[model samples]
Target: MKINKILNNNAVVVKEDDQEKIVMGAGIAFQKSKNDVISQSKIEKIFVMSEGNKKFQELLKTLPEDVIELAEEIISYAEGFLKVPLSNHIHISLTDHISFAIERLKQGFRIQNKLITEIKTLYAQEFSIGLWAIDLIEKRTGVAIPEDEAAHIALHIHTAKLGASTMENTMKHTTMINEMIGVLEEESGSTVDPEGISHQRMVTHLHFALNRIETGEPFHDMDPDMLELIQTKYEGAFVLSQKMAQFIKDEYEVSFPASEVGYIALHIQRVLERT
Candidate 1:
């Protein structure tokens, strides 16, 4: 591909397939001019923009090279762990976040994430990867990142999976799930196993439930007979589910529907059986 614009000594913008792509490598653009053919052997990473080239180009211009490289490495590791291809925008979002995080640390300003516990509980795999990312950052830059940053990193990864532009909704869902799980553990007197199938089911159920609640979508109608039977058969779990419903009502001011209570009770029953 021919160089369309030079970004730095190690980075350049190239036109490929009538589209602009930001390419980076060591000394890849040194002494290179516009319309010059870039050497394939020297290219280390290429970022194709889905939104536009302006913001990404600006990010590359201001973001430190080491931070960008760390973001790429973290995304690569996350993709391998998740066994799925992540959106290319993660390269931009994650790099910008890490760069700014480092700057904030240098300025002695640390922001605490209220959703850290929720992020760790709900997105265990991604959160574990986030911790690994923290270690990688500390080793490379000698700047130790707090656990709160891991939650932020995991939120970025979760947003990438949905191809979303912001982390607001994701953080809300995570926080709600965490609070629900906290209620479950409190009532059951045991910690819920995040890696268990039961826990996964509960998380999936709550995820969709929260989505419905957020969008004001009504729950599917259920048979009153079955709901009564579930409540009677799993009385303990039903009571816990009631507590969960009340928690949601108090926290979000959205009343949890009765039709969904039985389903939540069933999940709680399964979790209780497992624990």
Candidate 2:
């Protein structure tokens, strides 16, 4: 197997029978190491490393910025799909994961589950992958995503293969709900004492957000005009929530873990922020 391209110090691209493949992170070959046979056991995953420099062995140490970026992209996708850290083997890196996830998303969306039960059963894995993808995106991107937004991604991943038209209202309300939670405070008496009403409202907004995201026309097409509408609704929700968060903060002045604040922030962002 002749060295075609070097991906990184521990990875390279090689050819078998003139076929191009991406070989992920792997062993390095130093200068004057040409024609040295790579161990069959050493070859890990395949990559389309078209841009590797000549003297691939010596070039192995320094990876091009784009290649590194590509590797990271693939790893994220793979981690999301496999729900685990990928093996060091280049063969199992993120590129393969991204390919697999996109394929699944395209296939799963084909069959629409208009009925709730069918959705729960037939599309469960797709939904799970969607959830996985969202969580990965959130943790990686540091963008607080609400449960509803997370659910939207899950549902879309479940139904992305389908040809059904997405609804616009979903994005609008989801944004609104997030905005609603973002500004919640312990003061100004915006929060309901019972807690039930607030919870119910939050849930309701979440549902709307999910529905819109899954089927919304505006968001699906990336309409710029919708930004203002989304922002306006989000502000309304934010005002309501700001007061509520303050209320809770004051009422529970006892130190609460930052996780609680994060959770609430995520909920709000989910409702208010667009992926």
Candidate 3:
């Protein structure tokens, strides 16, 4: 493919199959002009834009080579552990975030993530991988990132998985889920085992419930008879669900309708039965 534009000495934009891709390598674009054919042997990495995103090219041009390399290593490791393909946008977003984070740490600007606990509780696997990433970043870059960075990294992974626009909403949703679990535990006078199957189901239920709330979609419709039956049969769970609904409304300023209460009550009942 011929070079369509030059981003830097090591990177250039080229068109292949009528799609623009930014190609990068050591001295790949050095002394090269537009329309010059890039040698395959000199190519190290190629980034394809998702939905014509230009941020990746901008990041590749600006970020330090080592930072980009480190980000790639961490993402590769996460993919192996997750056993699922991640969005291509992860490379851009994560590299940009890590590069800025490293700069901030260098300047002695430390910011703690308030949602760290929620992230650890709700996304244990991703948070664990994020902690591992922290060690790897320090070992490779000699820059010690705080544990809070793990939460930020985990949120980045979560955002990529969900194709979300911002981390703020993801954190808010996580905090909501944690609060819901806390309410359930408080009502039951016991800690919910996060590792238990019931807790996992509750987490899943809360995730989708929050999503629907955010999108202004109605919660799953419950049959009137089933709702009443569940309310009577699982009185304790129904009571806890009421507390949950009120907690959600008070904290998030969003109403949790009765239809959702029945579904949430079922989840609570399952947890109570299992425990």
Q: Which candidate number has the best lDDT?
A: 1
How do the residues 82-162 of candidate 1 rate in per-residue lDDT, one tens digit apiece?
988887777778888999999899789986887675566667788999999999999999997999999889988978885
Q: Where in model 1 is the C-alpha error above 4 Å?
A: 16-18, 31-35, 48-51, 162-166, 181-204, 211-240, 247-255, 265-275
Arranged by TM-score with the best first, the candidates are 1, 3, 2
Q: Per lDDT, what order, best first?
A: 1, 3, 2
> What TM-score does candidate 1 get on C-alpha atoms?
0.75
As a TM-score, model 2 comes out at: 0.33
* Model 2 / residue 234 / CA error / Å: 21
Error of 2 at 186 (Å): 9.6
Better of 1 and 2 by TM-score: 1
The list of candidate 2 runs beyond 4 A from truth reads 28-34, 49-177, 183-208, 211-275
TM-score of 3: 0.69
For model 3, residues 28-132, the per-residue Cα lDDT tens digits are 888899999999999977877565359877777788878877787788788778776677778878998999999999899986986676677677878988999
Model 1 CA RMSD to the hidden true structure, in angstroms:
4.0
TM-score, every prediction: 0.75, 0.33, 0.69
